[model samples]
Target: METEKQYVIRCGNGYVRFNLDGSMIGCKYKSSKTTESHMKRLPFNIDLAVASGIIKIEEAE
Candidate 1:
């Protein structure tokens, strides 16, 4: 079976993963200062991330 396309964005203390449809898959934070609440405050949308230079659209292998 073919695998679904995915994307990723490396943030300050972690990374955010996304599906090809621009929906968020999940996020991971490495620092104690970073939390789900903080991540929630940031834009996770693919288009918004691109517009803000937060990430590029590249298929993850």
Candidate 2:
């Protein structure tokens, strides 16, 4: 089995992380300081969101 590395991007007061293949895996809420917050997957790509001025992606470490 292959495990692709995940990527995290800043969103609002929280964060959204997706797989290298662009699948949303998990997220966190700023209020509870937990990554277990459930979120809806966007119909478009995260990269596309950045390109289209929908969201800004933060630099990943």
Candidate 3:
């Protein structure tokens, strides 16, 4: 079985999580009022976006 790699990074005015290859998994805002806007900028869901399945987690280049 393969393993999933997850990492958190500061993106824009919030924080974001993505795979090693830079596939954005989720994001969060620094402020409560702008939380919704931050979430919308992400491509995936933090609660469900995993590195498993067909999503191959590779190294950054």
Please give each candidate's TM-score: 0.33, 0.37, 0.27
Residues 1-61 of candidate 3: C-alpha lDDT, one tens digit per residue: 9543333344444554544343654456422122333434556653343333322222222
Ranked by TM-score, the better of candidates 1 and 2 is 2
Write down the lDDT of every candidate, Cα atoms only: 0.48, 0.47, 0.40
Where does the lowest 10-residue lDDT sum fall in candidate 3?
Answer: 52-61
Q: Report the backbone clash tally of model 2.
A: 0
Candidate 1 TM-score versus the reference = 0.33
Model 2 steric clash pairs: none
Clashes of 1: 0
> What are the per-model C-alpha RMSD values against the true structure?
9.6, 8.1, 13.0
Q: By lDDT, highest first, what's the ranking? A: 1, 2, 3
* 1-61: candidate 2 lDDT, tens digit per residue: 9543333456655665654445654466422221212222444555577777654554334
Q: Give the poorly placed runs of model 2, Cα more than 4 Å off.
A: 1-8, 29-47
Candidate 1: Cα lDDT at 57: 44
Per residue, candidate 1 scores C-alpha lDDT tens digits across 1-61 of: 9644444456544666544444554466422222333334554544676678775443444
RMSD of 1: 9.6
